[model samples]
Target: MRRAAWGFLTPFLALFALFFVLPLGYALVRSLYAVRRPGLGFGPASVEFAALRNYAAVLADPVFRSALGRIAVLGLVQIPVMLGLAAVLALLLDAGLARAVRWFRLGFFLPYGVPGVIAVLLWANLYVPQVFPLAWTDLLAPPYVLAAIGNIVTWEYVGYNTLILVTALQAVPRSLIEAAAADGAGPWRTAWSVKLPLLRPALVLTATFSIIGTLQLFSEPAVLRTITPAVSAGYTPNLHVYNTIFTDDLPHLGAAQAVLLAAVTFALSIAFLRVTRRWSAA
Candidate 1:
C-alpha cells in the first residue's frame, strides 16, 4: 500500500516542482541580478548580480507603493461585502426558504464559470458611454473605477464562496440543530448562534483566498484600462509588475517586485490565519 501510494504521488510531485517550484526559484535568483548599460550607452548591456539593487528600486518607487495601497483599499471594502452576501445566500439555500433552490444555486454560481477577462470585457462595454449610454452616471470615472472593479470581483467569486459556505452548512450535524430547536432556538437564532459558529473555518478559508486574490488583482483593471483612463499601468501591483517588465523593459525590477508581492501575500495569509485561529479557539 505504501509503495502504491508513493507511485501515485510521484507524478503529481514531479509536475508540481517542474511547473511551480522551479519557476519560483528561477524568479528569486533572477531578481538578485540586474541589467545594466555601461559607459555612456556605448556598449552591450549585461546582466550582473547586483544584490538588493532591484529590490531597493522597487521599494523606492512611489507608483508601486501607490499600487499596493490601491489594492489594500479595494480588498478592505470588497472582501467583507462579498463574503457577507455569500453567507446570506448559503444560509437561505440551506434553510430551504427560497423557491427553486437548485436553479437559484446554479444561477448564483454561474458568474464564476465565466472567464475573468471575458467578464471584464463585458463590464467594460456596459461602463462605456458610447456602448451602453448610462446617462445617469459613469462607473469608469476616476473616483468610481476601483469600486467598479471590486464589483466585478465580487460578482465572480461570491458564488464560489457561497458554495464553500453551503458545503460547510451541509456537514453540520442535524442532531445538534434539533437540540438547538428543542432548546427553543428559532431559525434565525439557531443560524446566528449555531451555524455561524460552525462556519468559522470556511470563512477563514475564503478570507485568506480572497486576500491573496486581492493582492494579485490584475484582470479586471487590466481589461478596463483599455476603456478607461482611470486605470494606469501601475493601478495594481500585479498589473504594475506586468507593465514594468513588458512596457518598461525592466524584467529584473519586475522579478524583484513579484518576489516581494509573493512574500507579502504569504506573510499576510499566515498572520491572518494565526489571528483567526486564535479567535476561533477563544
Candidate 2:
C-alpha cells in the first residue's frame, strides 16, 4: 500500500524537481558567474563566465543596498501594524456581540480574497493625487501618500490575520472564561488574563507569516508605480531583482539578490521557530 502511495506521488515529485529544484540550482550556479559577450555581442561563443564578479558587484552596488534597507524599513513598519490591527479585529469578531456576526465576519474577511495585484490596482485608482480625498498631492503629500499605502496593506491582510487569531481564540475552552468570571473577573479582565495568553502561539505564527509576506512584497509597489512616479524601479528588494534581470539584463546580479533574499527569509523563519519553541517550553 505504501509503495502504491509513493508511486502515485512520483509524478508530482518529478515535476517539482524539474521545474523548481533544477531552476533554483541553475540560478545559484549562474549567480557566481557573470556572462561576457565577445565580438559584436550577437552570437553563441560570446557568452563566458566572469568568475564571482556578479556577486561582488551586487554586494557593492549602492542601489541594491538601498533597496534592501528600504524593504527592511517597510517590514518593520508593516508587520507590527498589520498584526496589531488583526489582533483587535479578531477579538471583536470572537466576542459574539450581536446577530450581525456573520455579516461582520464576511466583511472583514472579504479583502483577503481579493488578489494582491487587484487590491493594488484598486488603491491606485483611489489614491490618485487629484482624485484622492486624502490630500496626497498637497503640501502634506508625503505623509498622506505613506498613510495611503499603509492603509491598503492593512486593509487587505488584517482580515486574514483576524480569522487566524479568532480561530485560535475559539480553541480556548469556555470553562476557563466561566471560571475567571466566577472569580470576580470582568470581561476585560477575563480576556486579558485568560484569552490573550492562550493566543500567544497564534500571534507568533501570524507574525512569522507576516514577516515572510512583507519581505516578498512586490505586486503592490509594482502596481503603484503606474500611478506614482516616486516609486522607482529599485523601490523594493524584489523590484530591484526584477529590474536587474529583465530591464538591465543583469541576470547574474538578479540571481545573487534573489539568493540573498531567500537566505534572509530562511533565517527569519528559523529564528521565529526558535522563539516559538521557547514560548512553548515556558
> By TM-score, who's the top model here?
1
Best by lDDT: 1
Q: Backbone clashes per model, in order?
A: 0, 0
lDDT of each: 0.93, 0.80
How high a TM-score does candidate 1 get? 0.94
Off by over 4 Å in 2: 1-20, 39-45, 136-147, 279-282
Model 1 lowest lDDT segment of ten = 128-137
- Residue-level lDDT tens digits of model 1 in 110-129: 99999999999888777766
Instruction: Determine the C-alpha RMSD for candidate 1 after optimal superposition of all C-alphas.
Output: 1.8
